[model samples]
Target: MIRPDGFDAVVVGSGPNGLVAAVTMAEAGRRVLLVEAADRFGGGLRTEELTLPGFRHDVCATVLALAVASPAFRALRLDQPVAGHGPPPVEWAHAPIAAAHPLDKQPAVLVHRDLERTAGELGQDSAAWRATVGAAARAGDPLVDTLLAPLSLPRAPLGAARFGALAALPATVLGRTLFRTERGRAVLAGMAAHSMLDLRSPITSGYGLMLAALAHHVGWPVAVGGSQSVADALVARLVANGGEVVGGWAVRDLQELPPARLVLLDLTPRQVLAVAGDRLPPRYRRRLSRFRYGPGVFKLDWALSGPVPWSDPSVSRAGTVHLGGTLDEIALSEAEVAAGRHPARPYVLLTQPTVADPTRAPASRHVLWAYCHVPNGSGRDMTEAIEAQIERFAPGFRDLVLARHALGPADLEARNANLVGGDIGGGEASLSQFARRPRYSPHPWATPVPGLYICSASTPPGGGAHGMGGWQAARLALRRDRQA
Candidate 1:
C-alpha cells in the first residue's frame, strides 16, 4: 500500500520500537515508510531455526514485559482474543516462579505469584518480600508511568512523590530487610540483576521487583509460535493502516533516504550521527558523542532432545528461569561481569518455549533459549561455562542438547548495528544515563534539528522489551509535525 512517492514520515529501523512508532504514525493518517537493514522486517523479534531445522528460537528478547502495558499495543489489540484452543495452562500460563533459582548442591528457592504462599515459602524473610514488592505492586500504575515515561518531560508531582518515596531505599538494604532466607534473598537479587546493574548496587532492584509484580499481576506470556508472532502482529497493523516496510535494504546513510516532512531515527545515538553527519546540531552531536554503551552478552539457542530437567520441577512451568545458584552466588557472578571479566559461573537466563507452545519443535523435543551477561564485546565463547551452569542445576543438561548455536558480541553487533558491541539496552542503564540518556538534553527525543528525533532504548527508561521510547518519540514527532 505504499504510495511509492516518499512519505509524510519515515522510520529508519525495524526494531519493536521502530515498528511501534511507524504504526502510531500511520494510524494518525500519515503516509509512513519503514525501512529495515536486514532481509526480514522484525529486529529483535525475529525467530529462526538456528540449532535445528524444525526447532524455532527467538534471536533476542524472549519475555513479553512492557509490551502488554504499552498503551499503543493495548489500543491496537496486539495479542488479545486468544485464537485456537490448546492446553488451558498454555492459553496464558499465568504462574511464574520467582523463587526458582537452583542452588549448588542444595535445595532451590521457589516464589509463586501468591504473596502469602511466597512468604510462607520464604519462612522468616517473607515479611520483607511481602512489604517491598507488595507496596510497589499495589501502587504500580503511577510508579510504572513514571518509570516508563520519558524523563525529558516534567515529572508528575504526585507520581514523583510516590517514586521518590520508593526510590529512597537501597536495593541491598531492601532485600536484606525483606527476606532472611538465602533462597528468598537470591531470588530477589536475580530479579534485580535484570537491571544490568551491579547486584550489590542501590536502586537496581526497582525494575526487577516492578517487573516481577507485573508478571504476577499479568503473567509473562509469549505468543503461541514465538516472539516473531508479536512483531508480525504489529507489522500487520502497520500495513493494514497503509504503511510500507522496505526489507533487505540496509540504511548506511540518512541522506540517501527519500524526502519526508519528518524523520524519526529509531536507532542508537551513535548510528544516528553516523548516518546523518552534519545534519545534526554541534551541541546535539557533542551530547550523542559522549553517550555510553553497557556490558555485552553471549547468547545461545539450543535444540534439546527433551525438556530441561530442572532440579526444581516447577522451574519448567515458569516462562523465565534465572540460573545462577543462590542469591549470594548470583551477586558474585554479576559483580564479576560488572568488573570487566566473565564470571567463573555467569548468571544464566533460560526460557523454554516448546514447553509452552508445542509448535516450536517436533514432538517432545524442545527448543531451549538462554543468555548470560559477559563483559561488553567479550568474544570468549562461554558456551561451556553456560552449559556447566545449567548442568550444575540440571544434572544431565549436556546429554539433552541435540544441537546448539551461539552469537558473541561482535556477531550481535553485526546482526543489529544498534547493539554496538552487544549493548542490547541501547546504551548502559546507569543513574546519570537513565534520565539524561543519550545526553543531558531536556528533550531526549528532540534533536537540535527540528524534524529529527532519537527514538530507541538509548532514551529514557533505558532498555527493556517496552516501546515507551517510541511512543514518547512519536508523540513528540506528531506534535512537531502538526506545528510545522
Candidate 2:
C-alpha cells in the first residue's frame, strides 16, 4: 500500500515501457503510481473504432512478435493466464503466413513461421537464409536478449559475434551480397524497410535480420480483441500487484508529480525537455535538445466491406503485407523520404488483423490498415497515392473500403505526444542513437537527477513492443534504493 507520505515510485507516462516499469516496481513490493495524460493507459498500444463503428483498429503497434519474445514480458508471465483460466489476459492470434511481399509481375514472397518452408521458397538463396537468419534463430532467446539489450554481456558470444558481423552492414549491401536471387533480396528489403532508415544506412541489415529471425522464433501475432488488450492486461497486472493508475493526469513539470523516491518517465526527449528541463543539468539537457528524430509516417485505416482482394489470393492469409515492387523500388522510396521528398510510389506496409482474429471486425466484414513513410512533420495528404498503390496490387481495393481515416505526422503527434512528428520507432534507430540515446552513459536510464530515470522507446533496444528499457530502469531503481 502507498504510505500516507507518498508512493515509493511514480511513473509519468503509461506506454508499454512505463507500464512495465510500474509493474516491475510494484511486484517488487514497492508502492507504485502510474499516471497518464491520455484517457486510457496505453500509449502507442492503443486501439479504436478509427474508421467506423464495430471496426476496431490498432492506432499504432499491432504485431506482438517482440512482446512474445521479450524477457521482461516473459518474466511477468504475459504469455500465460492466471491460475483459474477464463482466458489469457492477452490472447495471441497468429495468421498462417506471418508476412508477405508482393511483386509487380511475380508471385508474392511469403515469410512463413517455418524457417525451412520460407527457406525452400527462396530456392538458390535457401542456404544463405538458413546460414544468416537461421543462425540467429538457433541461438534462440539468449541471442535475442543480448540484441534487445546490446550493452549487456552476451550469453552466446559466438552467436552475437556471428550475428553482429552480418548485422553491421547496410541492408542493401547484405541483401545483395548474401542472396543471389531477386526473391531473396526483395524479402530482405521488405523486412529492412521496417527500420524507416535508408536501406544504405549502416546497421539497417541488423534491423531486417532480427525481424526475420523473430518470425521464425515467434510468429508475428496480434493481440486478440485489439492491441489495447495488451495494455489492459499490463494494467491489470499492475493493479493486482497493488499499483495505482490514474488517467487524464498530465504532468507539465517535475513539480506537478507527487512526492516519490523515484520517478520514471515513459516519454521521449522532447516531452522530457518540456516537463523536466529545469531540473536536469545543463549538459544532459543540451544533449537531449540535439537528439534527432527520423522519418515520420502517413497512416490510413479503413473499414472494409470484405478482405483486400490481392492479385495473389495467398496474400490474404498473411497478417502483414509489404507493397513495394522489389528491393530497388523499396530502397528508392525510403531514400526519397530520407531526402525529405515523398515518393510517388512509396513503400507501403499493410496489416489485416481480421485475417487471424475475426473479432476485430463485424460479421464477415474486415478492416485494412496501411502506412507509408514521409518526411518528419509532413502535412501533405497521401490518401490518393496510398489507395492507388494498394489498388495496384489489390485490384478493386477501393471498392472494399466502407470508410477511411487518415493521420499525418502532426495529427499523430497531437493524438499521442510520444509519437512526436509520427516517428513511431521512437527517435531515430541509427547506430549512434542506439548507443547514446538521449545521451551516452553507463546507465542512460538514470539521469543525473536523484531518484529519477527515463525508460522510453528512445532508449536502447530503440523501438518495438519489448519493455527492456523499463525492465532495466526498474532493476537499477531497486538496486539504488537498497544501497541508499
Candidate 3:
C-alpha cells in the first residue's frame, strides 16, 4: 500500500482520554490522528440501542462530575452545562433515608445533597457532615485545581500552598472526622466504596473523599444525551483542529503503526506490553507485569416505564445514586468482592439519565443505569440482584421495568480490552497506583519507547473520565516533538 503522510502524533483509542489527548495536541498546532478499534469513536462513552431501537443507554460512565473538575477542560474552552440535566432536581434522588440494618432498631442512614438540610436531618452526626464536605466545599476550587493540573507546575505560590495542605490529609482522618453520624459516615463511606479497596484501607478513604468533594462542588450530572455527547464534543474539537480519526483499527504491534514522531496509546499496561514487546526496558516491563488490577463489576440497564418510585424522594433528584444501604453494609459488600466471593448484597452505583435528558428515551420512558461490585472477570448476570437492591428501596421497582439487560465483568472486558478482567478505573486506585499508575516513572505520559506514551485511565489519577492521563501524555509528546 502507498504510504500516508506521517503525522506529528498518533493516539490509539477514542475514549474520553484518547479524544482529550488528540484535542490537546491539535490545539497545540500539531498534526494528530486518533485511531479506534471499534467501528465508531468514543469507547466507553458511547450511547447505543442495547435495550430497544427507540430506547438508548449509556455503555459505561454516565456521570459528568470528573469532566467538570478536570483542569484540562478549563483550558479547552469547552462548554459543558450541568443544569440542563435537571441537576440537583430531577437528576438526584434518594434510595432510603434509613439503613436497612438486619435487626438494628436504629433507622437507616440518609444521604442528602444539601449540606445544611442533610446535617439538620441527621440526628447526631450533623457536626461531622458540616465539617468535612462543608470544609472541602469551602476549599474546593483550589483543591481541585491542584489535583487536576500536571505534577510539574510551570503557579501562584498561595494557590500551590493551599492545594498542598489539602492533599496531605490521610484517608481515615478525613473520612472519620468529616461525617460523624452513622448516616453521614455511611454516605461518605459509600462514595469511597467506588474503589475496589477495603473501606478501612489506608488510602481508600482519600479516594472516596476526593470524589465526594467534587460531587459537592459540582453536582454529579450526566451528559445532556448520554456520556457520548462528551466523546462527540471532544472528537469534534479534535477534527475542527485538523485531527483525523480512523475507526476499526486494532493496533497489535508498534511496528505496524505509520511513521510518527510520537505514539500515544489509550490502553492498559498489558496492551502496551503486547504492542511494544521487547522494545520496552526490562525494569519497565517487569513493573508493568506486576501492576495490580482491581475487582470487576456487573452492570444492569433498565428501561423503566417511569421514574424509579424511590421511597426517599431526595435520591430521585440526584444525577447519580449510591445504592448500598449503610456504611457497614457497603463496606461488607466491598469486602466480599475483595475476597473474590460474590456477595448476594452488592453495592451498586446507579443513575437515571432520562430524568435529566429526554433524549435518552421516549417522553414517558426512562433509562436506569446501574452497576454492582463483583469479583474480577465474574460472568454472573446481576440483573436480578441489582433489581432486588433497587426494589429494597423502591418497593415497586420490578413492576415498572419494561426491559432490562445485564453485563458481567467478562462481557465488559470483551467490549473494552482496557477493562481487563472487567477491572474499570483502568485497574485499581491503590495508593502507589494513584500517582504512579502503570509505571513509577516521573513522566507517566512518557513510556520506555522514545516515541510512545500511555494516555488512558491506567495513567495518573488512575480512573474516571477526567482525561488528565491523555492531556498529560499528549502535552509531553508534543513538547518532546518540538524539542526534536
Which candidate achieves the best TM-score against the true structure? Answer: 2
lDDT score of residue 374 within candidate 3: 83
- Tell me which of candidates 1 and 2 scores higher on lDDT: 2
Best by lDDT: 2
- Over the full model, what C-alpha lDDT does candidate 1 score relative to the true structure? 0.76
Q: Which runs of model 1 end up more than 4 angstroms from their true locations?
A: 1-4, 80-99, 150-170
Candidate 2 lDDT over residue span 202-264, tens digit each: 999998999999999988999999999888888888888888889988889988777999999
Candidate 3 TM-score over all chains jointly: 0.89
Clashing pairs in 1: 99-109, 99-110, 99-111, 125-179, 125-180, 128-178, 186-327, 296-376
Cα TM-score per model: 0.93, 0.98, 0.89
lDDT tens readout by residue for model 1, 18-83: 888898899899999998889876688888889888898989976675776555466667745333
Worst 10 residues of 3 by lDDT: 94-103
> Tens digit of lDDT per residue, candidate 3, span 375-469?
78887777788878888877798999898888788888888889888888888877767766876667987877788899988888678888888
Candidate 3 residue spans exceeding 4 A from truth = 1-3, 80-114, 153-178
**Stretches > 4 Å off in candidate 2:** 1-4, 82-88
